[model samples]
Target: MDKPTGSTVSPQEALIYAMVTLSAVDRQMTDRELRKIGDVVNTLPIFGGFDTDRLVAVAEACATITREEDGLHAVLATIATSLPKKLHETAYALAVEVAAADLHVEQEELRFLELLRDVLDVDSLTAAAIERGARARYRTL
Candidate 1:
């Protein structure tokens, strides 16, 4: 998705885009996933300075990018270009978190995670750890 202007996407926005993309990957955005996204933005230190109200707009922008021709590719490209190397893992982690939100990992979501991991260049070990952590956090009784 090409931005009309030359301004870069902020780190926090990049993270949000990743989460939103993952949530919408299955073509169905669940309430649990949406709530997890909101909770993450509200509670994470990385988003401490971000305004919560802007989340809907940012997520809508991401959803728009994902609806264009080759939208998934476009969204991944935007994410890869927007995020710095250091925060790539954070992006993947957030994606994993959102995917795990509903306590059910669908095939589409899993594929999206794989695609995201490759795009973010997250090492296998780190990706495994992130996935494990999300599983642990979302575990049932």
Candidate 2:
């Protein structure tokens, strides 16, 4: 679905693609993960001016791409190209948050994070810090 991540893909759509890709990587979109996606859209400053009504449609578009051949790569490419350099870290953070939401980060999720880090050119230190923050935020009592 490279076409889905085409030139017209907005930054918001790119971000959603990142989160959806991670949440679907394990082939199980847990309630916590799904809720995290919704929360991120509703609360984050980055998502300011975004249309809540389009949330489901954007998410479905991304989810569809993830099931296609090299869909993950397609999504990542769209994200890297569409988002400004300032948002690379933000995109990674969003993905990490969703991965941690279920409090059981699967191996597939970890691999996707690693790949995303590289694709986004996120420094290892920054990536580790964001990941740690997500773990703290989602940790069980």
Candidate 1 structure quality by residue, lDDT tens digits, 1-141: 232122347888889999999999898899999999999999999899899999999999888888899888777887888887888999999999999999998999999999888877888999999999988888999
Native-to-model Cα distance after best TM-score fit, residue 98 in candidate 2, in Å: 0.3
- Please list the C-alpha lDDT of all candidates, in the order they appear: 0.88, 0.86
The all-Cα superposition gives candidate 1 an RMSD in Å to the true structure of 3.4
Alpha-carbon shift of residue 57 in model 1 (angstroms): 0.5
- Model 1 local distance difference test score: 0.88
Error of 1 at 1 (Å): 18
Q: TM-score per candidate, in order?
A: 0.92, 0.92
The TM-score between candidate 2 and the true structure equals 0.92
Tens digit of lDDT per residue, candidate 2, span 69-138?
9887877777788888898999999999999888898999999998888878899999989988987777
- Worst lDDT run of 10 residues, candidate 1, spans 1-10
